[model samples]
Target: MDGETALDALQNLTSAAGTNYSIDKNSDLGDMYFNMTNYVGDTLKMMCMMRSHHMLTDVVLQAGSEQFHAHKLVLASASPYFKAMFTGGLKECDMSHVKLQGVCPTTLARILQFMYTGIIRVTEVTVCQLLPAATMFQVPDIINACCVFLERQLDPSNVIGIANFAEQHGCKELHEKANQFIEQHFTQICQEEEFFQLSAMQLVALVKKDALNVQDEQDVYQAVLQWVKYDEENRRPKMEHILQAVRCQYLTPAFLSKQMKSCDLLKKLPQCRKYLAQIFKDMTLHKKPCVKERTPNTPRVIYIAGGYLRYSLDILEAFNADDKTWTQLAKLTVPRSGLGGAFLKGMFYAVGGRNNAPGSSYDSDWVDRYHPVLDQWRPCSPMTTPRNRVGVAVMDGYLYAVGGSSGSDYHSSVERYEPDEDRWTLVRPMQYKRLGVGVAVVNRMLYAMGGYDGINRLNSAESYHPENDEWTPISPMHVARSGAGVATLNNCVYVVGGYDGSKQLNSVECYDTEKDTWEFRAPIRISRSALSLTVLDGKLYAMGGYDGTSFLSIVEVYDPTKDVWEEGEPLTSGRSGHASAVSFHQCVIHCDQHEHSLSTESSLGWCSTRPSSTLSALAGSALNGAVPEPRTSGVGAVSNSLSAPGRGLPDGSGPSLPYGP
Candidate 1:
């Protein structure tokens, strides 16, 4: 009949059937159907409108000069603080007007709006005030929103205050993120006034961390001195406690001499002078004094995989940058050079490469996974194509293999591996075949750059989008380079030293993905090719490679902000065609009785090349004849047996320390 009559009929049927119906449409159990798509939104909006008009408002929340009218049931359901006040045996349960202490009127108004509308605006002006009120009221969503906002706003100038605030408010994740920012920007943060405001213990705690991203230990010393100078009269008395954070052993002899001669503070403290004297004496005697704690160069262990020195080598060496020491790990399953290495989900994967022996054509399609906790290796699914000098990266939980050669011919094909499924599948190929390519991932896009085609060394580059399975060309380099070391930092992709057609080139280039442009950066001192590059603690470590005339053991570190390069300790020996990955594991100098051997075969039908005695020999060379220590070998054994430097073992089996974090 009419629209109103039809609507009345449906409502009558619905009222007879009840609010939630179970009618069978096919059986024609009911003649009417009803639904409200925006029922929740409408009901909440009506409640908000009623409160705004002060209609049937049951309670008044007073904060300073401001007051808000709200329903007790709505407020109680939205926040635990209000729920406890209304439902628990609190006096406010019966009170019509409740006054809130320690809350700003404006912030209280925002909280009331969020409680009614499920939305709130957090700005720089309001966040500081709103966070505490939200935390006090136990509104988790607003608390998280405030934390996320603060995390994004962190910078060198304000990070210290943000970190302190996060700690005070018990925001664990935000505090950790802010602390990480402090460590990453320590050099810049030292120049800020907020850093000078830190307490002595807080200053000591920041500087003592091995992960502090200072290019030179001298910076750390200067930072501590500056902190003390900020309030010399009061802080001078605490100098001894703060100075412990400076690794005196790492300061250069020249810097120490300069400071001792010019600084009046060093002249006043006998203990500081004595400590400096002892360090100088140790330096003169060529004795590296042991720091009680294991403070490595970076917090993570840098694992150098197979490489070619004279011939292809299977040696796996772990380098601790802080102590400038190397410890030999178990030998690789195969002798592989020109391989690609990466860490995915706490495991290190060594990808395709060739056994570069003279007169050999043994290119490999293997993928070996190392369990950091177990200190053992197991094979994953091999790639569909054999690759040497392959460029590899991980993005979106999948490992990607870029262009490489197969000994006889170069390839333009690319493949992706799924770790959980143990499957390898081919994706779109690149525009040109390349060997000695440098591949990196930035903003989830994989980039392949600088490799040798059959006829010439190529300066071209391309990027792959996994979502569309497509490859797009990008800007070419200034000159052709093959075997360049590539890494990404601060959304910029850097390509380091590689070989041109005539000679080894030390020129470096950085590409900004946002701008799609390239610029020259400070190059390594040594001209090299086939070097391994990885980022650790906000610095780029360019490991051993070949310098055309000879295999080189040089390790140069790049500070991007300063645009300068500094030489770190060299590798144990000259190497080329090596691979590097940062892992959270450290290895003991000696093997345990229950150590898992590399001889075991995986279900995918891959096993170690052979049980080599060369591993022991290499271990002897790396570690100076230290006696073996016994450890129970398993994942659980790691936490119990991994001792810090100078900490005695639980069973009193050995006194020597392991070489990892």
Candidate 2:
């Protein structure tokens, strides 16, 4: 007998056991147990070995019994009768202690097999029974296996039962899976009376928690309607609750309105009718509001103005920094009595426009430049072609003028304005002439959205690129409109109210540059066209415009974050075709009505009340400089430092508008 022979014998025994056991020869046990003993030592070893073997066998038998007892203890945790027999054994067990349990014995046997061999075989019938036992024993693997088997067998008809079982056991994953399955198959199961028995509050909870899909939502609505038939008085309160929940969750107004009409709930209850109306109004009025606030950190504001009426200027405003307020800074010097303006670099160049003269040509080649910094107006080189009611916007610092009407005739001529040389260059003309169209810049590209294309109001839109001077067609808008105000915010360009050939439009639509798609947004509070559009602090403000009958002073602010519109302070004057601009410091709004004079009130620039000495010290520390000695006269020293550069505006010319309002 040698070490090799002993090792071979152990391997043979392990193979014969039929258990998946393999001893590693590199293990510590292999090094210690491999050697064999001599003949005399072997005799002594045989006797010792026999005793040791007996002790080891006894220990293993005791361990097996203990394991059985432990298993019984775990089972007894779920039931008491099993505990008494396993813990007290036959010696102490009696009929009185053996209280019959309801759980299947076969299920218990399967659980015991899993505990002993770490293997489980689940059948459809026993899966339900074994799941609870596995959960009680804290056997995660067995519980998972049982759940998988149950899930695979579950269908729409068995969803309720599966949901109940999962809920009772507090199995979150299983519950979610069952809930999703039920939602996906709700149409098949919703015909049952049990679903209708659920309270309206419960139904609402299901919808709000996303436990129902579109089909399931329809089923719930149908079921709730059916419930109302049996007991109107009992179900009215529930219906109201469900309607309120749906409204709060921001469901489509059209769908909610349909539901209300289908159920006749609104007619039955006065309060329900009022609530429904309010929800519809609120949904239609939803808008994104301005979130950016003016602070000491804000820099400068840029203003742009343009117009289409005689002696009027239509303004297209924008901000240069992160601030949300529109500060009137830039202006159009030579106001095109009835023309459009576009911005390039820091200058707003007024495009082709017309002056009032009956029977005279409605076209002028005049252009103006208003310096934002100097707050003064000056003349700029005019356009090559004279036209009015044109679409203008800046792309990559080049001003582009789209289609317009020249001398009572519509022209599709396109021109580009260069600020450096103060000259206009002709570009490729548009395929169709579009007058009073909405123009917007998104990602350095100009979009010529819906407007009147001479013959009829057009729903068509097109994109222009300055790099190649090429025009490409885009998907048309939902409504054929003209005079719409277009502005871009958060990467989406919004086309606000305009006229749809026959009537003024209150419709609002958005175009996503990333998706290259169009969608209807919350319409404006009033139907209008020729309105001024600007984005300040991320919120879009739709200012003065004509609604069909009269000019509007209504100013509605759109909040993108909340997707709601709130009434803002109306402009001092109601005039369409105004100019708007936003900057980090303030918001500047301008209109072309001479009757509505411009306000000289300062827009309240960023003002801090902290002591001048403290501010100076802070500034010094930021620059890593030594603390300067304070002057004896506090008043004079404070005034001098506070009046330094970057402190505030130097001229204090109220806010600047690119053109005279």
Candidate 3:
């Protein structure tokens, strides 16, 4: 049962069996077994055969001459590790679990030397053989010993083998350690000529993992270019591979310029110039004027629709020109609704809404798609969960739906849908649950703005980056509100009217993404929640919604440049809960009239019939009587803040007045 007693008994058995003992002469077993060197070799070979038979046959031999004889047979043909293990005085190691049975005798002997003396002599051939044996034996110290011996031997010629070994062993840390060693010692291996010899897949993996330093990246770029320039037949397919690597690394402008110069060197190659141009086309950042003069007779109407309403559809529309005529595009199929919608490429998507009842309904799953070119609507894939008042936007051609309310419960789940694939994949949930949220996209990033989180309205904003599939907090809005319409105009997001927890608001706030700040602007003429705001012809327009008691027909325009709001012509009919879109020449409004019909006498009675004079009278009143003294209380309070170049009216006409009631 004791270690020393077990070894002494095994040695006695091997010595009595006429086995050479010199194999164990220099080991601890010899010192413990009374200097049995006379039988060391024979004892070692006998133990090796016994171990091999035990490993292959799963049989245990009695601790006597019979076991010693079986081990001798195994040692004659066993692997070096096994031979080393047997001769190194390992009298009783459990050999039944040995995995590598094909190792050679000489290799096994060296392993035995290491096992006995804790020193391994590694050469090119033995290094490979010992590494696997060390791992198989579960001897970490020996494995590290092998690694140290191999580290000094690594050069440009052997880096590929080291990398392969590291990968095979699933030792990422070791792989990195080996890679660093190779990078330091074998610079020529990463040179242009040498690097080009690597497979494209390997190059891509290296760049993607950011495994290369600046010097290595430059070397790789140069080598890839050289191959493409001089060895066209072999490197033609590698052009795309190189470009992908460059993009992943986000090479500096200087490096890109160098790449461009190298591209010129491949001028004679087929489609080389075209390929280079395609890689740079509209992908790199470009600087240009924000607004360009519109060509004469060009149509610039943009349409937006889809949200929730109570008992009817609530569509909001805004026009772009001086004509501030807000129209009801269409009503929803139901009413008492709060929902989310997005414009993806050319198709407009609307989804999710809740009713007045405490619970959400499957009716929220109604998904409508509108094509601008054909001016029509069709059904598309519905969301997995019937949520109300969700945040939706498109980034990188994928649509993301953020937190919303399912029934009365608030959810923080986020889902992404790919239209081309017609599939939705769940993503990491947001930190907060929100409903009636505002969503916008800027610089390819999606922003979820102010919304209600059930308990109170939210002013905090968060942005999601698809590259990492993560969200980061941004500047919060000045005031918390839900059902606020949001739109990106001139690279800044404008949060229009929405209902605060207490009341509907007309206050407009603009968020500067670059500055990460928010500033108040001209409030719309009417305070409304669940209204829609849109940009047309470079102007911000607030369209129809309920003021709280009844649906509104008034439309207002905010000149961001001037920081002033002016009333415009009203919708043709007095109906709220409608969707709006910028049409060819006007703001096309759609009214959801499932509950309230346009033919209803009461609806017709509330329609505004005032002429254009209504605008002039209101302007005159605002400019003279209602205009506040230069105190910090009214429009004049921030007069100095209105420093933008005044909006140039159509045909250079002055600001037009609204027709009188």
- Every candidate's CA RMSD: 26.0, 26.1, 28.0
Q: Over the stretch 1-661, how does candidate 2's per-residue lDDT look in tens digits?
A: 5545554565565456554333346575555323332333433333333333332211111221132112333344434544555566664343323222444556655665554445688875566677776666556777789778766654544555666677777677887777766564454545544455545655666544443433113344555566566567887766666655442323435556775676566678777777767755554443221122112222334354544332244334443433343334334433333356544443445566543322222356666654333344566666776665567776544677777665435667788776667778998777678767778876556788876665687888888755566788988888887777888888688998877766777888999876778998888888887776777657888877776655666778899888777886565455565555443321233434212112111223112232233212211211111222322211100111121211111111001111110
Q: Write the per-residue lDDT of candidate 1 for residues 1-661, one digit (tens) a residue.
A: 5545544554565456545434335356556554654456656766776687676788999999889999999899889999999999899999999999999888999998998889989777678788889989999989999999887776666778778787878899999988877776677778876788788988888888876655457778999988888898999988987887788776656567677777888777778777777776565443434553223332457889998765667888777655667767766777777789988755788998766544342667888887644556777778888887899898756789998866456889999988879999999999999888999987557899988887788999998866578889999988788888999876689999888866777899999887789999998899888888998768999988877667778999999989999998788898788889875323333243454322121222222342123211211211122222321121111112332322211111111113210
lDDT of 1: 0.74
- Best-to-worst order by lDDT is 1, 2, 3
> lDDT winner among the candidates?
1
Q: What are the lDDT figures for the candidates, one per model?
A: 0.74, 0.55, 0.54
Rank candidates by TM-score, best first: 1, 3, 2
Model 3: ten consecutive residues of lowest lDDT: 652-661
Best by TM-score: 1
Q: How do all models score by TM-score?
A: 0.47, 0.42, 0.44
Candidate 1 TM-score to native: 0.47
Where model 3 places Cα greater than 4 Å from the true spot, the runs are: 1-298, 302-310, 314-336, 355-363, 372-375, 574-661
Where is the poorest 10-residue window by lDDT in model 1? 648-657
Off by over 4 Å in 2: 1-338, 357-361, 583-661
Give the Cα error of residue 196 in candidate 1, in Å. 40
Clashing residue pairs, backbone N/CA/C < 3 A, model 1: 296-322, 297-321, 297-322
| Candidate 2 residue-wise lDDT at 90 | 64
